[model samples]
Every structure is written in structure tokens, then in C-alpha cells.
Target: MTSFGIATAPQQVEYADVLRVWREADEVPEIEHAWLFDHLLPIAGDPDGPIFEGWTLLSALAARTRRLRLGLLVTSNRFRPPAMLAKIATTVDAVSGGRLDFGIGVGSRPSHPLARREYAAHGLPFHDTGRATDSLDEALTVIERLWTEDAPFDFHGEYVHLDGAYGNPKPARRPPIMIGGRARATLRVVAKHADLWNIPGGDLADCVARSRMLDDYCAEIGRDPAAITRSLHLGVSYDAPEATREAIDAAVAAGFSHIVLGLPAPWPGGVARWVADELVNRSPAHRGT
Candidate 1:
């Protein structure tokens, strides 16, 4: 089934406003998933606005909604240590009744001003993507082992080191781990590890091209390309909702099974309703059998 979901940009909205969106979603049975971004602050524009923490917001939302699968689009590995992150995902998944999608990324763009500000605020030394990806390799290693292993173990890596690590209360179900990226190095990580590969903001042909590149990586790694679900994050216009319909159809045609519709915060008037009535109806999974 082609699963469609909402991935909200929370920079412009407050806690209460976002809650309304979640409640609106609760009223719409067709909407399959609900998501947020793991941004310490806004990705762009004025960084002075209120930016809610992704995991905390998700934990709160978990208590409010039942059906919509929850996740951040791509959480940076630098935000939290690897072992802790795995435990957090485990706890949230248990609380949400196995509805978590563990979306993670290497890190944010080193050149981005907001990212730089965020790093400075958190006292995490900023590094280029190369170093970030290396750390991410180690981080994912720890996360997966902790999530699945039955006994305590030690993790030794260049960037991360741990001993007697145990992720208790293992999730009732294993949530799909989505690695989000576009570059070749990141794609290799996705090929080797990701349960779902999410590529954010790209045209149709670009997505097809990237998918092929990921396929190449899978082949080189002696892995099946089909093992990983391909997901696309597309910016949508609720005003011209037809454009969204076309984009969703095009993305599905291009071999993306999971479609994440990204909406600007302070939602455009009637957008949520339009999504429920129009966009969700486009999904065969949402339609009548």
C-alpha cells in the first residue's frame, strides 16, 4: 500500500496550534501517519521563533493520537548520544504501542546558519558531513545492536564508545529505521542499514536518479534494493491542492512507497480538511476495497 503522511514544519507554529493539527488528523481516518522534524531551531528564516523539540513533542502527541504512525523526518545523530537515542525510541515505541518510525540522519549541513547556531547553543562542535557521516555509521551501529540484542555488550568505535549497554523494555515491534540523505556517502549508509530511505526535497527525475544510485549501492553491498522502502518528502501547496495530487501520483509512479507531505507551519486555511478530503483519497490504501 502507498502510505501517505503529514510531516509538519514546526518553526512557525506553537505547541497548541500543532495540537490542533494532530486533533484534526484524529478526525480523519484516511491520514496514515503524522511526523515532525528534529530541528533544534528553524532550518531557515528568523531563528528567533519557538521551535519545539521533536522527541518531546512526539511523546506528547503519542498520548493524543492512536492510528497515525509518528516520527521525526530526520533526527541528527549529534543531538543525542547513540545509546540514549535507541532507548528513547524504544520507550516512545512502547508508549505509542509500536507506532514509531525511527527516522535518523548523520547531521545537518555545516554551512547552514541555523545549524551552526544550534550546534553552538548545544555545545556540540560543528563538523563537516564527512566526519558527521563517520560518526553516524558508529551511532547506527550502537542503536541497532542495543535495540535487537538480548544481552549487554560493548560498542567500540572511533567517535562513540560504550560498555555494558542494554536497551531495556525492547519495543513490542521493531520500528522501521529511516536514514535520510541524498549524497553518495549517506546513500551507502542507507544501503547498508536503513529499513526506509527518505530523500527530502527533490524533483521526480531527481528522485528516480537517486533511487538508482541507492540501488547501485545495494548491489555493491550484496543487498537487495527491494529490502528498503523508498520514501519521499515533498513540499505541498494546500491552496493549489491539485498540484499536490499530481506530485503524489508522480512520486508513487517513480517508485516511492511512502509519501510524506510537508506543510508549512501556521497551516494555510482549510488545508488539513482539503488533505483529508482530497489527498488521502488519492491513495489506493485509503480508498474503499
Candidate 2:
């Protein structure tokens, strides 16, 4: 069966506004998960507008809401050391009663000038795509080892090196890893590591093509393609509910079983129920299921 979730980017919005939506989503059975994005500065309107840090805000949201699985839509692997991220995620898992889904990826691409500026503004190094992807591969390796390894260990990778790294009081559960990206190198990592693979939805044909490429990569690695859930992140249109429903139907038809509806800011009151009634319930995928 298909699962549906909502993403409220922590950009240009107040914290209480987000809390309200998540609390409502918690009571709605149709919405199984919720997310915030990993961005330090505004990526949308009013570049100087306030935005909350993703992981910190997520912890607060996790504590506030009881039912929804929560995490950043996809964390920027560049923002924190893998071992540090492992510790943070474990804490969230405990706080949420084991409902964390760890989503991560290489940071914003070099081409996105708006997203790129945050790196410099925050004194974070923004490497080229090749280097960034390689780093992500290494980061995931280090993170998983920290989560599962019994003893403190050291890792010497090209991008990250750790000395006596360990994660204590392991997560309530090892959160399922979800990696989001479309690059082939990223896809190879997804095939090898991710429990779920996510791509932003726009053109249906391109989305399916990327999914097929992932399948081929899985074959090369001798991993079952079906082992990884296909997740699509599609933008939600409060004004055009039918259009959003149509997009959801097309995505579900293309074999995306995990749908994350991206709700833009100035979130309407009762948005979670609004989503269930207008988008999730109205979509043919949900109706027939």
C-alpha cells in the first residue's frame, strides 16, 4: 500500500505555525509522516526572512507530535560530521519513541546559486558535485558503523576521518536510511545503502527513467530493486487541489508508493485534514486502495 506524508520547509515561517500543522497531522491517520528541510537560510521568498534549523526544529516537532514519523526531508550530509549526525539522529529516535526515518543526501548542487549561498554564509565548505557525492558515500558508511558497531572504531576515508568514533545509547531503533538525489553516483549509493530512495516529482517520464536507472544499479550491486521503496516529493498547491491530486495519481501510477506532499509556507489552518480530504482521499490511488 502507498504511504503519504507532508513536508513543511522551515523557511519563511514561524515555529508555532509549523507546530500547529504537525499536531493536526498527528491526529490524521492518512498522514503517516511529516518532514522539515535542511536549510540554514531562506531558499524561497525574502532571502533574509527567518528560518529554523532543521534538526533542532525536528526534535521539537518530534516531542510535540506523537504519531507521525519525522525527519528532515533529506539532510545535507555536508552540514555535520557523520558521527555527530548519528548521535543526533539517535537522540531524536528516542524522543519520538522510535519513529525517526533518517533521510540524507549530498548538499545542494553547485548550480543552485540560492541554495549555494547558505554554505558560504554559514562558513560551510561547498565542494564540487563529484567531491560532494564521494563525501556522502563516506558519510553514510561512517554513520551506519556508528549506529551498529559494538566498539569504538576509526574510519579513514578520503573526505572524513574519525578517531575513536562511537555512538552510545544506540537509537531506540536504527532509523531507516532514506537518500534523496538523482545523480548516478548517488543512485549507486542508494542501491547499496538506502531503505528508501526519493526524487522530487515534476516530469513523470524523467522520474520513471531515474527509477529504472536505480533498478539497473541495484542489479549491478546484486541488490533487489524492490527492496528500496520509491518515494516522490511533489509540491502541494493549496489553490489547485485537483491539480495536486492529479500529480499524486500520476506519481502513484508510476510506482512511487511513498508520496511526500510539499506544503508551501503561510500554511493554511487545518492543513493536515485539508490534505487528507483534498489530496490523499481524493486521489484515485487512495480511493481504490
The candidate that achieves the highest TM-score relative to the unseen native structure? 2
Q: Which stretches in model 1 have alpha-carbon errors above 4 Å?
A: 268-270, 282-289
Off by over 4 Å in 2: none
Writing each residue's lDDT as its tens digit, candidate 1 over 75-185 gives 889889999999889988987889999999987887677776888887888877888898998899888888889999997889999989998888877788999999889
lDDT of each: 0.84, 0.92
Candidate 1 displacement at residue 203 in angstroms: 2.5
Q: Compared with the true structure, what per-residue lDDT tens digits does model 2 show for residues 1-289?
A: 8999999998888899999999999999999999899999888899999999999999999999899999887999989988889999999999899999999999898888889999999999888888888888999999888888999998998989999998898887779999999889999899989999999776889989999999999999899999999999999989999889989999999999999999988998999999999999988899777
TM-score of each: 0.94, 0.98
TM-score of 1: 0.94
